[model samples]
Target chain A: MSGTPNQGPGLRYPSNKKSIYDRNLNRTKNAELSRAAFAYLFIEMIAYAQRGVSNVGDLEQKLNTQGYPIGLRLLDLLLSRSSNPLASIRPTRILPLLQFIAQTLYRHLFGRPADALEKSSTEPGQYMLFDNEPMVSQYVSLPRELSSLNCAAFVAGVIEGVCDGAGFPTEGVTAHSVGEQEQGKDAKAMWPDKTVFLIKFKPEVLEREEILGRGGG
Target chain B: MVVFALMIISKSGGLIYNREFHTGLSKLTSNDYLILAGSFHGMHAITSQLSPAPRIPYITPQNNMLAPSPFPNRPTGIEVMESSHFRLQCFQTQTGTKFLLVTEPQQPNVDTMMKKVYELYADYVMKNPFYTVEMPIRCEKFDRGLDGFIKVRG
Candidate 1:
């Protein structure tokens, strides 16, 4: 520190500094990122989370926690990029919010929309977003003992984060690989990385959705 | 392009990484490496400030209204040092972390190789939440990446 001037870190900042908060998210709607870079980063992220964890489930949870904050941050970034950036126009109902995640958010991050969206007939307030081959989990292959592990847990965490940030708290979001089952039944052999993200919203979110619906009447 | 070794010095002059990609160079004690990193960091800081300012006084109070300057960012520090045995190249990132590459003397384009190393460090080490800043980087992924990168270069 002797040769350097005694100035705060702020002085090092560029004079024409631009804040990420001030940037328009929608401007890069067509931008693309290198898949190799993304895959390598995701691989390292998994390896980092795998350290010191006792079981596969703990690894999944760690990945979830890591993805949670990203989800929360992306919630604002994605919503603000919409044609209607106003918070008042944000999706208040479950169906629209699910569509936003499945279509809008998925398209932005993965370059393509999620494969499908379905609601559970037996369980109310439960929705599922399906990805025939979730981009993040494309190269991940679990051993037989850890076959239960799904790398898509990180994506589920992001979804959960987005939901929680948008005033729709959820019971939990989980990822289940349906490749084996779907390959046999649905004959979707190409998508061996098929994953389903089950999002179970809290009871209060449903009640709020109903109340919001009534108020709009 | 006979590269010898790579060393990463933390922002405050600590030795976070020292790896030898090619053999035949004399090795020093770990403590000596630390001292070398500290002194280099100090020298870098001194040299950065000592850079000759351009004669044109394009910067002004109302700089925002002006067109973007064609000049690149300010020179950070001593980029290259030549010796009979080896040539040392330094690349300092905007955040103050420095990467030093030791290659065979007269090796061309060390700058590009150093830039690639910096990219790996940013992705594998800095992005990992487990990596505490200014501490010795023990990330396995970083090591693997650095190894792979050097291998590809050769």
Candidate 2:
């Protein structure tokens, strides 16, 4: 889906340059992957994370760390594909930035917009991202010791990655169960039905959120 | 391939899954469903224990619950649900986690479905950093995949 970059069309740019556009050619339409391979890979990832860590947070941090680089890389890649390309994520305000993250980043990561974007009524600078069924946690059931942690921390890491990759600064992203506490309220969160991604910002983001609030762009 | 029905039972015999992919199987109450899972789990356990071979007396050194599965190579707990029109293939993970796939009696292949379910579990729930093992499954991807997979199979 790569169109010619802003350098304009038809003026032969570096033919051998490693652009995202160049890489899209390799993904054939019928490049179906074997599920077994993915399972083994994921299994190995869990096994590896289990090593050298005594606590669940440490293990999840490891996973989140693993996904961070990919997130950062994807940020630039996704923007490059956009028509205006956001020009380095200048959201200028919290609302714009949050909308961009929930809409753009979610699309980049999950192939669709997030199920919902919300702000905590009681708290400012706290944002929540909702996903009815996070694809990453489909077959998993975690031990109780780490139930408070969200594996989508990896997704949070990715969002963190993208935010950090851009000029915007951020704090850690944590995953939570936003699923209805009662069953049948919405059966989706029954096991891991809903994922509430908590995006805490760095103080700088708050500072910027205010500065931008006063037309200080 | 067509999977006719599927069910999941927790280690404690709680009915965690009850799905009918084919019309052959009869529906029952939630309590009956729990009873069915407990009965099957008991039967499976009994069959394993009462195999013709004598029970090999063995003592463990203790404190090794996570030891490599003793039944790794042996035919572990899994079976087929047979009915007039279809077969329900069952697969249980080594961690006592089980998956049931309902398929047409004459379906050619089911290895892919089982593997795919496990894969989705790993990605959506296990990888979910939020999921805790050995508890109930609540991840949406797993449910969605199960629904989609069975719908097409049916």
Candidate 3:
């Protein structure tokens, strides 16, 4: 896999040191990763993060922190790997940023777009990203003692990291288990792992979004 | 020489996993297997303490980013046990999960196989979010991966 940097004859460059920057992220944009492999690595990451933690809350926090840097790194790689003609332009508005996450980022990570996106009815600077059955939380059955713990907090951290990296500067991002209540009791059996990621942006971010909206950037 | 069986023992001397790959040896009852795992765990602890390696003093330079530890502490225990018919290899991870692979006596490159198994365990078993620690592993993906690796190599 570690071929020559520039696509040419396979010439030996033994003396030169290879750097991460020298690699092309765009080439692997179409490449698919094994779900099992990803799951295993993710599980190990959770286990590793769980070490030296007191409670489930702390464990979730550790997982979130672990995913934060990945989100930051992915932001740059995703932008660069975009096939769109306007790929160079960063997402300036809240809607576009959220769309980028829901459609583009979600597709790259989980091989599908997010289920739904909505704005808060009563609250300003608040957006909701919904997933009927969040991939990360699909198999996780929390014990009664640690019922409040949501593994998707790591995913929320990733979203926060991406937003912050893209200059959104969100106040905080959190994943809440809405479960099957949203679909109502009468509805034919649906996903029990329903989750809504509440994204609350900083006041400054909202102000910037308003400016960007008016300017039509 | 080929691997006949694989077992995983939890830190508390519980038999978390037992799988037979080949029919090279007589099959032990589940109860007997559990007893064997428990006894092995106890013996491993005793052996580590019984034969302690002399400590060597070393200093790590602060500026050396490549050096993780100047004096790396090694896991002390019986690693490989060879018998006339079958050779048993024991690999205890940093977290104290024991992997026991039963192979034919003259199996070559068993150490490499053990290392590969450890890598697979770290990836498929440890990384799985649904798998509870020190519990029986029921991950289908882990089983499939192990099966594929061993089938191709064995």
Provide the TM-score for each candidate, comma-separated: 0.53, 0.54, 0.56
lDDT of 1 by residue, B1-154 (tens): 6889889998888999998888766888899998999999999989988998546556777986888866556767798899998899998877778899999997887878888888888776766544567888776557777887888888
Interface RMSD of each: 7.9, 5.3, 5.3
lDDT of 1 by residue, A97-182 (tens): 88889887898888788999999899999998899888776545454567788888999999999899888999889998886654
**List of chain A TM-scores, every candidate:** 0.84, 0.73, 0.83
Q: Reference contacts recovered by each candidate, as fractions? A: 0.00, 0.23, 0.37
**DockQ metric, candidate 3:** 0.17
Worst 10-residue lDDT window, candidate 3 chain B: B62-71
Per-residue alpha-carbon lDDT of candidate 2 for residues A1-217, written as tens digits (9 for 90 to 100): 5875667566445657666656653242355566445545666666677789888788778878877898788766666656664555455566776677788777655566888888878767788888877756544555556556565666777877766776567668777776465445647435444788887777888887787667854
Which has the better DockQ: candidate 1, or candidate 2?
2
User: Which stretches in model 3 have alpha-carbon errors above 4 Å?
Assistant: A1-25, A185-189, B1-154
Model 1's CAPRI class?
Answer: incorrect
In the order shown, the candidates' DockQ scores are 0.03, 0.14, 0.17
Q: Which numbered prediction scores highest in lDDT against the true structure? A: 1
Comparing 1 and 3 on DockQ, the stronger one: 3
Where does candidate 3 chain A have its weakest 10-residue lDDT segment?
A185-194
RMSD of each: 12.6, 12.9, 11.6
TM-score quality measure for candidate 1: 0.53
Candidate with the larger lDDT of 1 and 3 = 1
